[model samples]
Target: MIGIATFLYIYGYKYICKAILTAKVMFMNNLNAPFPLLQSNKVKFISSFSFGFFVFVFLYIFQPFGINEVQFYKPLFIGGYALITFSCVAFSFFGLPLLFKNTFNPDKWTVKKAALYTSFIILIISVGNWYYTATIGQEVISLKHSFLKFIGITFSVGIFPTVIFLIFTEKTLRKVNESKAGNITKQIHTDLEIEEEKQENDIIPQIDFLADNNSIPLNQLNFLCIKSEGNYLEVFFFIDGKLNKSVIRYPLKKAFEQVNELNNIHHCHRSFIANFDQIEKVSGNARNYELHLRNLTFTIPVSRGFSKDLIAIYK
Candidate 1:
């Protein structure tokens, strides 16, 4: 009996801890079930053991199945039988998650998986119970006559309880998902309102450019510069702490007019427009007056005609 208890305690300790962590993340993350110590394996094992022990005690003391429950004679003495029964019940509850981990996996849960898991656990428990009764209880079993009797007894213990638990679990999960969806929608709306308020108070302007069916909104302060590429213009800007660009089919001369209202912007070259306030350094003279801008890796060419205007803005 001690050997059975020790074997159960050791193996149950190993399997239950890992099983609880996986089940909590997979099956209970958003649902927020009230088992706080599910995150700790030691606590989970103790909880399972204690609860299982109490339930077995209640059933044993009351003898719910009466004296001749299955073809087995009543244990004229239950002290030894009660201890073994408690060990089995505790082991069953502690190791249950390990048995059905795949069924509760967050990414792939379904009604089919739940039903399959229920069947597998029931089959295993039935076989286990048959062995326990044959070995430890006062039940004499013959290969010929007791096989069907064992099946009938084990089936009664395993099936209905599992089906009831599965039904309650599925209904609870459906309600949690619906509630979470409503909260997520409200959060998105609140974020959009906050962003609009910040844009209104910003010192630099926000530019809205129509880019193929999408509207790309660029903050003026983070707008590095733009360079004309034949019929297209490559617009550079800083967003999410990264330098990014978009190629749009707009004429450079026409693009300049759209942004001319901004005081710090200047047409520094026939091919380039510079945001003067963003310039970190200006080098070279007349022929090659290169302009280096903050947060930009490359320099912009300052043509002879635009050199004086760019230099004046830089100083």
Candidate 2:
């Protein structure tokens, strides 16, 4: 009978662990929405209460401790037992996990931390059992022996469930990461398709660039940088992962007129035109400003007049 009672107690909490942990995984994998209760700490307390209620009801029905044992179904005794056990389990679940919040992160999980957490849980359950037994007039013959028994019983209750929770948490996290990666890959493909469609429909009017004997293809993604050289302009662009430069004999105004059709490119100064999307950094005050563009060795000056427009664009 004692063996059956011990088996049932440990087995009951193991079932509870699976129920609550499975619910947690389902909440995480839910595509539409998550349950509100699971979002808050109340779920922990509620889960504990439910498991306590189930165990108490099972014990009530079976009376497994034997007919010689004291009545457990009496209103006062049962209510007090329910209060103590539920509060202990609820506090253990609701509070202890949070105490190691920084350590509990799955990415950096350590065996040392997990062992410590397990030990703490066992201690809590053991103390809770000791308190319950004391309240029921169970006299301590030897304090150390009673403590050892409580530790052993609580260990049996805690170990298997802890293992289940950790395993489920690891598996759930892996599936979530895989799902995220798949979604990200699909999104990237969609974005590329949209941009390709836009390029096909869009057209650039030909501006005779006489600098390096090359015409600027406004549709291309990688146009490096442009600079003013005396009255002529230097148009530096990229092709096939290589840098190409052309000196346009025309003034900056003519180049701006041609490049203005592209939204990502901006005319920032009388001597400079920049692809705003490629800019790495912007520096300087009202008197003098500079735009540092990515993948380019040089920086472009930002004229005082264009500063307000740049600010407005960002805002």
Candidate 3:
């Protein structure tokens, strides 16, 4: 049982590493975009330490190796723990970034694509672990027993936890984005009002039509709205409280291009971009700002770093 478990663990880990590396190489070579790679040494070290501690605690409690018959503080025990920790750290340092690099690229993977990739990776890992465990042992266990054991381990320790984590993270990110958007809207509106009063004119400067593939006539634009469509963004200007509903010319990264040039336009959140001219009112607290734009109300959050900028714009 012990040998089978060890083999499963090792095989699962190696397969995950290889899969991630392959994905990373493919993304870098095939897709030429400036996406962030997963190369955080600090995260790798911390994860390794945590994994090692968990393994140590598990072994200590279970005494799986009949530690009561031998010295618990043996040199072999320390060496084993060290090896596991180092191996995990090394693997994560190389593997995680590779996976992230491939999965995070806007040009390469859409939300559906990313989800499919994750499912495939998980399936491969689970099956690989099961096969390794079933075949490694000398004692012949029934196929049913091995299958059931594999299912139990996978559901309890792998799939369930990962799914829960993803759900929680997604919820948190949504809230954060909403709050940021509200704050940006408020700031832009306040700035616009001040500028308007000074100039004594209601007309806001609009972008002149440029004969470029990227250029859009300012006259054709009405209200800038940023909507999140999974990993992609849907950008359209509202016409009389209705979505103009034109196809987005660029991805989220490109949509944000030259945003600084638009004096009254700013990205309120990762999922939302807004125009100050469209904002009707600002409500909510420091952490959460709500914007009333015509008939629509949206929340924008103020991250700690952007708080000063937000305040300055409003003031």
Per-model CA lDDT versus the true structure: 0.57, 0.58, 0.51
- Provide the TM-score for each candidate, comma-separated: 0.36, 0.39, 0.40
Quote the positional error of residue 220 for candidate 3 in Å. Answer: 11
Candidate number achieving the greatest lDDT relative to the actual structure:
2
Question: Candidate 1: which stretches are off by over 4 Å?
Answer: 1-66, 69-104, 139-148, 196-315
Q: Write the per-residue lDDT of candidate 1 for residues 1-315, one digit (tens) a residue.
A: 999999999999989998999987876554432211122355445643543454345545665433335345444333333344345544544565577665444334444544454455445545554555567553532332255564564455444444444454444444443344344334434644665588677676666755455465655567788899898889888888888888888888877876665656888888998776566555552123567788888889766556445434423
Residue 180 accuracy (lDDT) in model 1: 42
lDDT by residue for model 3 (11-126), tens: 99999999999999887664442222223466446645654555456545654323334443443553354344445444545565476775544333333553554454444444
lDDT of 3: 0.51
Better of 1 and 3 by lDDT: 1
Order the candidates by lDDT, highest first.
2, 1, 3
> What's every prediction's RMSD, in angstroms?
24.2, 21.0, 15.0
Candidate 2 per-residue lDDT over residues 1-315, each given as its tens digit: 999999999999999999999998875555222111112355456656754565456445653332126544344443454465577667666665578566554333344554565577568767776676665635321123377776876565455555654564445544543454344334545655666678777763333333345656643366655788897788877668777777767778767777766556777877788877555555552133467666778878766456556655644
lDDT of 1: 0.57
**Candidate 3 lDDT score at position 284:** 46
Error of 3 at 229 (Å): 15
